[model samples]
Target: MTISIDATHLADVTDFLQGCEKVVGSPNVLTNAADKSAFLTDQRQRFTGAAIAVVKPGNTAEVAAIVKLCNQFKVPLVPQGGNTGLVLGSVPDSRGNAIVLSLARLNQVRAIDPINHTITVEAGCILQNVQEAAFAADRLLPLSLAAEGSCTIGGNLATNAGGTAVLRYGNTRELCLGLEVVTAQGDIMHGLRGLRKDNTGYDLRDLFIGAEGTLGIITAAVMKIFPLPKAQLTALVALQTPDQALQLLTLAQGRCGAALTGFELMSDLCLQLVAKHMPQLTFPFSAHYPYYVLMEISDSESEAHASNLLEAVLAMALEEDICQDAVLATSSAQSKTLWQLRESISSAQAKEGKNIKHDVSIPISRIAEFISVTDGLLQQQFPGCRNVTFGHLGDGNLHYNVSPAIGASVEAFLDQQTAINLVVHDSVHAFGGSISAEHGIGSLKREELLRYKSAVEMQLMRTIKQALDPLNLMNPGKVI
Candidate 1:
């Protein structure tokens, strides 16, 4: 491996770019501050920074040269793909010394081997286009999300993103069979085979998937593809409590089998927020239960069976007092209407107030306990804190959010962020859960991750980071 960056050679980055322009064309590189400004800030606008330049490598060979040049100059390189990452992994540093290597120009659908039921795509390919390609081949990518239209495959793989379909098809990492990465020194790690099983010597592909570019830049990937579901069933079940939501999940899972694709939980507070903030959407069910779960089960079999399964589950759950009331979507449009209630939480919350949220995870069995305990704890600690809880209950991840007190000043409430974080994270730790669930640690949870991670574990992370990015050039001041 090439030695990392040194402050002494920092001035030579411009010279390196000058040399690159001679070889790889001037149009590919970006040094202007305005263009780089948008590249630096995150979607949340939480963290912003500067980069020496944004290098748009048009192809694999060009990317390799940019990496080699950066390596020789010892310039920190931040590999970026759509720049849609919630985490600051794709953003550059405040120092404005490290180069941002943009992979967007490498967009290509190299192969779609429908025979093998696999698609080989470059990292920069937009996720929507990937889905379209798969659809054209009469298959579904099955990794659907709100950002699917804008996010890139590389970003998804890097974050190991868990979207709506994660309960069924799995996250980005699980869908992956192989990968192609650009090492710190710009060498390609190409092992793009659609192999179902391979007992390779250490799984190097898995390392780069969720490393947040601390290890290597994911250039391309070979991901698993699944057959499109023939029929889909969506339901809105009003539950009395969180435990009932769990029971509904169990009942749905029992009947639907592998087709139980999603079981998303929503607090009545969430629906209220959605209705209050988003005036366009009307509630499918009346304001009744304290909790609700929007579930979708898809099968290649029969819609009748799937509907029957849901009805049976709802009937049993209601009879046993597991759920208060249930309503199945009579049409696709109605189903979408029900889904919109769950999907609009973030925007609704944003409009409501400054959200003090914790995206944490605990054991499935401990979910009921966690919900009950956390609600009480929040009420005790911060008397005015409103507990707006919801998320993928089946996967044991919940967005345990504590909104700013209704009557209190926002700044004052946000002032206790650190203390509030400790309260939530400590509870998560008590349950053997990660400080972060779906979202990457990014700038938000870096300190929390350090606090929760054991000394030995933190040391290992530091070592790996040091080995890959010695100068700390890639997405500096974030993650590890």
Candidate 2:
């Protein structure tokens, strides 16, 4: 059902507010501008929207009741968690005809079964908190990202978030065992089972996992966990080019196999920016290289064993000319500092100037080609545009970002965003890659998705959307 924006019923905010208050007490319904301001904007501050009220519900029952009231009053709903999304999927629209349904108050660890390797957590629990809970139970929830400190599990599942560990533990979809969701019509579906081998019909759990709240609101979930690694080995290696990095990855994988947990790639330009902006950070090597790889290996054995394995792999890589230089972290603090160099790329880029970012994934074999081709094309068309590339190379996902030259006007560079995106995304599509790897198709890429997705695929998605959210009251005008 395609629901168009209409302001005719917005005048009934008073009654809607009263209904919401009845569902989740009056104090939880924030209507003032000051109270709703934080929920109205996205993490990047790229988009600011309006909402009739920002409602916080404390439990699944309250979430159901609040959703039920929204449906009854014909009010649109935007289910938000942490508001940490890169895409504008979590915020309300500018029309102020919707309600921002916040699940922060619903956060709680419902259950933990170490033997079963599953942890049941409420939707609003922070990602880092979930990781810590798993650690407390002698398990590991490996869906890690830089924003884990602020991003919520529900948001992670909603976006099907892919982080550095995707090369190993897989995305949020794979990490999840079951989900307790409130349907578009406000009916709670208690499907939070930790069974690993359920041949259930239609796979309803998956439908809502990456739906971005267009079909339903995720209230809680049971996620899969793994045994905690006894030791971790981190290394920062310099390479002449991406091809060399790729070779190093293949070698490391063959040498370490399942112990290899992370393989990140960054351009020398990225490291230079980090050095210039973040003077306190220490680089692994004194001289700069064109590319670098931050690789990590984890095992259920002694630290010495893991380190020996890593040293052996690095020795092979060096002898084979796959890497120019390597630094094996000698201590936990040194390992953290090496990882911080890779994690600080985004912040360093922000300090440079206006930038165009693309979260794309291509075939592992064609990653180097994609970078080379796109970089050349960008330079040719938009002269002086700096390309700062880095990402989870092991998973074929790259943050292929471009920024204007140091002295260029940010506004002028932003004016050409559409053209820049066309060049970058067109190359990604030609390489048989997805335009959005971790981030879902929020309003940012809705039109691009239509152009790229096959007609049959789009039709199938619409069919599901119609079947589940006929009224289109749940996060209308986003995703599909």
Candidate 3:
């Protein structure tokens, strides 16, 4: 179905565009198809939506003015950052009635308080730039992820993203101290306090952090920073199974405590795909095991101390037969090379063919059992489907992905996405796990969210949504 606008509706849209142009110069208001193409598409290139125009506001005042204009014209607005979100939360719908509110021009580091250990930045600031700024100040913003190079802080907070350092520094939500948001009614909430504790009324910051812009637009944030680690070490340990990996995790945590920064688990097939597609990345192990774990430790002590701690943990694991073989990186270059193999799994899988990805989190104790049971069930229902499982085992999150059987049509395999999701998500629920862990419930998994959440939980979410956005003008058709 398509939306057919009459003369009156078309006139209203024209007036709205003119009003937006007045707020932020005509050059910032993109209405041509060529100008709006990049903003209309998603990161995966899976879906392309339609928007009346892409509006780029220069400052918070302009953003508030444009949002007020949207409300006046009865136009829906989709708040967009770097547009690197995997789900469709940052893109407009196909109705072509909404405007894409781009925050790209609002990029700025508002303040950096070294004494307070916090950095205040606009929503449009790229995550890598923030990290560099922190590094320049001899501090660390440890929200590390693959998309950090291009993903914006607003998108990160909107989705409550969890990345590689989540095992230690926590998700973007935990690292944030405050946020500056533009409400649905064009009101600005100036909550950018760098305080660690504030026993005020309701915690509005928590509500908007993971709302995916359904509640309001995040303009800026105050994020916590930490003293940089003096030394960091990485190691790759080959294990026989997920069970062994879990055992290794327990041992590492018991030995290294908070110094353990990363514990990533990868199946043998994951590296095989990497070797097949990304030939430049060399596999560290001489022989393949059923599974591998890439672990890291960051110490405030010297490099020798960090190395000794990591080596001691690996030595203990080897003595206990928890792992089959291990290779510890002796240099920073070697450490990066080892990390590259762990990070290349997703891209390598994409190069192979179309596949379904499930970012799930299960209890630490039941993860091994969940994998064992779920893999068997998937194979029983859809034989020959390859399971490329890997993720941050320390945090109980797994990127459990699936590939088509060799010689099978990729389209045919993808056609069974619904059935495949049912099999995997059902098992996850059976083990007390979440269907969507780090990624927000964008339109991609909205229906699945309903199936998993209870009626009471759903109703509470809807009540909150209704109270905050009564007209449903803020990013409709997402998260409820």
lDDT of 2 by residue, 282-355 (tens): 98798999999999998889898998999999999999999999999988899999988988999999887668
Q: List the residue pairs that clash in candidate 1.
A: none
Worst 10-residue stretch by lDDT in candidate 3?
A: 1-10
Over 4 Å off, model 3: 1-8
Is 1 or 2 the stronger prediction by lDDT?
Answer: 2
Local lDDT at 402 for model 2: 90
Question: What TM-score, to 2 decimals, does candidate 2 have?
Answer: 0.98
For residue 378, give model 2's deviation from the true position in Å.
0.5
Can you give the TM-score per candidate against the true fold? 0.95, 0.98, 0.98
Lowest lDDT block of 10, candidate 1: 1-10
Cα lDDT of all candidates, in order?
Answer: 0.81, 0.92, 0.92
TM-score quality measure for candidate 3: 0.98
Residue 48: error of model 2 in Å? 0.9
> What lDDT is reached at residue 437 by model 1?
78
Order the candidates by TM-score, highest first — what do you get? 3, 2, 1
Candidate ranking under lDDT, highest first, comes to 3, 2, 1
The 10-residue segment with the lowest total lDDT in model 2: 1-10
